[model samples]
Target: MKSRKRKIQAPVGRAAMLSLQINMLRDECCAVAAQLMKRKTLDEVELEDCARLDDALAEAYRILRHTVAKVTLARLRRKSRTRQQ
Candidate 1:
C-alpha cells in the first residue's frame, strides 16, 4: 500500500474571516462575563471593575454586530451580482 498525503487549505473568503472575528469576540465576551460573575460571587466586585467589564463586553458585542452586518451585505451583493449576470 502506498501512503497518501492530504492537503489542508486555509479558510478563504469574507465569510470565513467574519466567522473568525465573530468567534474571537464571542470568546472574549464569554471570558469577561465569567470574570465578572466570579467577582460578584466573591462579593469583591467594585463599580469600576464592573464598568470596565461592561465596556469591554459592549465593545465586543458592537464589533460582532458590525461583522454580521458586513457578512450580510456581502452575501446580498453577491446574490445581486449573480442575478444581474
Candidate 2:
C-alpha cells in the first residue's frame, strides 16, 4: 500500500483571528439582546438582563478598539520599513 500525502493549511493571520473574535462577540451581543426583547414590556426585563447586554456591548467595543490599534500599528510598521528601504 502506498502512503498518500496530506496538504497542510496555512496559519491564520492576526487580522483574520481578530475578525473572528469580533464576529463571535457580535453574536453574543445579539443573543443577549434577543433575550431582553422576548419580554413584552420594558418593565418585564430584569436588571440582570440589562447589565448582561451592557457588559457584552462594552466587551465588543474593547475588542474593536484593540483590533483597530493592531491594524494601525501594522500599517505604521510597514510604512516605516518601506521608507527605510
Candidate 3:
C-alpha cells in the first residue's frame, strides 16, 4: 500500500489575507506533526511540546492582528483628515 500526497491551497483578498495566513500556518503545523508521527514515534511528552508550539504561534498571530488593526485605523484617520480639507 502507498500513502497519498495532498496539496494545500490558500485564500485571497486583503482583509481575508491575514486569516488565510493564519490558517495556512495552522495547516502546515499539523502536516508536520502528522508526518512526524508517521516517521518517528512520539510519547505523550512530545505531543505536549507540539501543543505548546501551536499555542505560541496563535499568540504571535494575535499580536499581528492587533498591529494590523492599529495601522489600518491610523491610515483611515489620516485619509479622513485629508478629505476634510
The Cα local distance difference test for each model comes to: 0.64, 0.67, 0.70
Tens digit of per-residue lDDT, candidate 1, span 1-85: 9999987633336545665675676566566666766773653455456556657756765776677677677868988999999
Candidate 2 per-residue lDDT, tens place, 1-85, comes to 9999997633336556666676667677566667767766644446466567667756776876677677777878988999999
TM-score of each model, in listed order:
0.47, 0.46, 0.57
Q: Candidate 2: which stretches are off by over 4 Å?
A: 1-44
Off by over 4 Å in 3: 1-22, 31-42
Once fitted onto the true fold, the runs of candidate 1 whose alpha carbons sit more than 4 angstroms away are 1-45
Q: Write the per-residue lDDT of candidate 3 for residues 1-85, one digit (tens) a residue.
A: 8998886532223534775587678677777677668865666666677677778778867776777677677778988999999
Ranking by TM-score: 3, 1, 2
Most accurate candidate by TM-score = 3
Which candidate number has the best lDDT?
3
